[model samples]
Target: MQSDPAAMPAPAGPRENRAVLVDVALALVIGWILGAAAQVAHWSGQLAPGRRHGPGPTGNEAGHDWPRWAEGMGQPPPGVPWPALIAAVVILLAVALRRAYPRAAFAGALVGAIGYVAAGAPFPVTLIPLALCGYAVAGREPLLRWLPIGVLVLPLAVAGWWQEAAVGLTEPGPYGVLLITAAVLASATMLALLRRARRDAHDRERREELRQAALGERLRVAREVHDIVGHSLSVISLQAGVALRVLERRPDEAAAALRAIRGSSTSALTELRQTIAAFRDDPGRGPTAPPPGLDRVDELAAALRAAGREVTVERWPDPLGPLPASIELAAFRIVQESLTNVVRHTDRAGAAVLLRRTGDELLVEVADDGPPLAAEPTPGGGLHGMRERAEGAGGTFAARRGERGGWVVSARLPIGEAP
Candidate 1:
């Protein structure tokens, strides 16, 4: 199981829910707007031309009548009685289900269209429901490239051609209805595909970010292990050597050395576990131990002092203000790792640590007054670990030969505003 939040698929939040509702609402709004536009075009034409194409009753009315189209607006095309109201209900149901069920929505829209046609309603009015389902079909159905245009557009066009368009109201002609239906469905389909493409792109970016975060997290754990176990091992090795040297003639000194080894090992184990658990978080569970920070720097120096190394800590600005845990922890890790390298690589008992708060940044430098380092500095796990810790905490890190002699490790870490 992935422990990272970025790795998990996001739940549909309020914004997504609102978006779905908006799509459904837009169906109704778009249909009404298109219906009204058709009305406007119908009214734009003269009543004389409409009388040519529009149906009417006898020879006297039909001859030279051009046609007999009525001009009005009602839910069921201005005639055909109260039974035609079911068409509106079915169309509304189709619109509501468009996002959730494309096939079913399409079926409902078709049924409603058939109902309106059966009621002697204008075919252009029925095209509204059919066009509304385009979004759902284009988004969810396969063969989507031309499927929506073919399936949705052709039907509305055919129905308009077969029926007297101005059944009760002067509506758009078959060609007008065809163009309007195709335009709506095509627009809806294009919009749906665009939304899908954007969503897929967003998901890809999120996954890439999660991959990078997981990689960075793993590196952080490795650094923690190197700092914790590496220092402990170094201390343990030194203590063991001392114990061996004094065991023959001085039992008390050897016993004290053994105690130091035990202490370091136990502390290392406890902290190692805490660091591991911090990353492997679970519901209602958290790291049991507080992370080591600058407050523990004195304790680190004291430990080195007891281990026969003279380690001194100098803090400029006397005392730092309350610091962010991240900055403090990074500083502590750098100091710890730097001191460990001094013991393991240099045959010296003296190392100096400087901590200074400079504006929005904190500067930490650890320099050992030992013999000069190699001209070509060899890369080691300890140095790499220290560098990673500093940079990982949004800091700059460099380890080079000191001006005078020995090795100097410096880090400049960003310190955000204190709580």
Candidate 2:
């Protein structure tokens, strides 16, 4: 048994079908220009007016006197044949296909021009298709290959010889119209080249923009992982050490230390999975907690307390209403990273976390009574990640030695329009 070919759905249209429609209109206009010019006169000596040749074309006959020097010699036809007219219609249809098949259209038109002369046919009209085709294909191809298309102008000049025979003419002479034809083709080719160049430049800029956006996103994810996993691992290491030291004596205290380790590890793994899923664009994974924000800063301090470090938080003009999500996230991460650094780099040092808000800005500061902080960041360092988050949120960041002792980290983030 055979399947029905017509039953299959048609393939979707090209991405740029709108351009193809414009080409159809351009094709019709070119067809009219050539069609109107072909009907202007018949220069064949046998068909000239007052000759005995059977019934010359009755309309649009030329008023100029025939050249005296060419009384015997033949002149190229000012009109084209029926076959040439049909070829032109086919050429016009090809012109409409220019958007999708520009090379084919140009090749067909070039072939038509060369075919007319190769068959010994005489006419100025045959070359019009080649000039029209140049608008679409000439500039798109290499210069060395398409230059030959300009050679057809010689025959056009000879066919227009009657323009020279005209006496007292205000219009251009024989080569004047020829110059105009060449000018038209040249203008078309130059314009095509310019458009192609502009499109190429736009493509380059778009690719660069996309590359930068991806880089920024990856850096953002790295900062997130650094802050989340770094803080949790610090607490786990401290709690595990405590549990091992008291395993034999003080069993209850050891059990409590182990429980803290389990809790810290579980929360860190969940947050890590969420960040990885977002980076991979995996929406179907397990539902995740909302991003940590300024509201979670107290939780960070409480965790540090569990790891046997004292953290004091002070807020002035407490933020009664919700701030923009970006500012909140940046502020929370700054505090979390500062505390983590104290835990990892110092021996049970006490820390202070401070947050304040103004009309349109939030200020976050963290200070540890430990040795001076030295930030020689290598890719995913805590100080660098905090600075990046602050600046990315359209804010400022600073890390400097405290006036009396220790190290201080501060950030200022603006509250922009919220979604």
Candidate 3:
């Protein structure tokens, strides 16, 4: 079975859905409690006394306790306990839903207000929920669409002036209109701010991802550097030692070690150039000329002799034939680096290098009879360099403690003509 290219994961919508649900449930519970409290208060008639004899208007509803302040007039008293309770509950539900789920919350507020009207709440009072719904809806929609919703309520506003749809309905005059208008404007502003906040969060996440990618690139560069330089210097050190020792006893042998050192140094310089080229981005920069092949092992051995390490090279004059550039470089570096390690780390008087070419491949071995040295850390800078050179050329690299306390570095590379 194959994987579908279109499959992907998304999370934001679900999280927002859950948040809205929790808010609505909380609003519902609170609205119920407030309504019940308002009913009990109204039942006591503690709001105002019965109509008694005389003055301007006895039992004037204007003297009763109003639930909310609007325009210039107070809304009618909540009336009897049950009616008052029901009205209180409606207002609570509207206010709660409007603020909580500003967009989706509008539905609940609208429903609650209509219920209050059915229960005989006054017109000016009923306007409370309508105003809240207006503000909330206006805030949730884009700027251009919000004003039309305000225009929708004009007919209902005009109807309040004539008579009580029930006993409590009344015109709230200029104050009511002004108050509701203010709420609509405020809601629109809040929505703009919420939109801005979301954009800022998205930008922050993008920057963090870029920072992590840069860090990874730097680490890869460091590893490649360690692989190239470490092994080359070790080989140079061993050859230098051989050259120095032979200088006193055999001028010819000393000269050999010096030659080997020079050869190895040249190889190191070439590898460094290739590494730098790998990192350059200019399209003009192409892969460099192929690296040295293993056929040059004799020259490598002579370099060690010049460095003062006793060196012996045994091989078919051209044991390793033509090989791929990558494989050739790998084999050369492996041999070069191993000899370098022997010169640098061993006090051995002499070292032996062997190259055996077989069908489609070549095996290289470097062993020394130098003074014993303790084991060092795995893939230390030098060994790591040798390993990379080998593996990169489609080969393997291994270095370990030898039987006589000396160390050996060996590599096997694929066969092909040298680049």
RMSD in order of candidates = 7.0, 7.5, 16.3
Candidate 2: clashing residue pairs, number: 0
Candidates by lDDT, descending order: 1, 2, 3
**Each candidate's lDDT (Cα)?**
0.71, 0.69, 0.58
lDDT of 3 at 140: 58
Global Cα lDDT for candidate 3? 0.58
Worst 10 residues of 1 by lDDT: 42-51
TM-score for each model? 0.71, 0.76, 0.41
Clashes (N, CA, C under 3 Å) per candidate:
4, 0, 41
Give per-residue lDDT, candidate 2, residue 291: 76
Candidate 2 lDDT over residue span 153-199, tens digit each: 54444432322333213334435545765777788788878988898
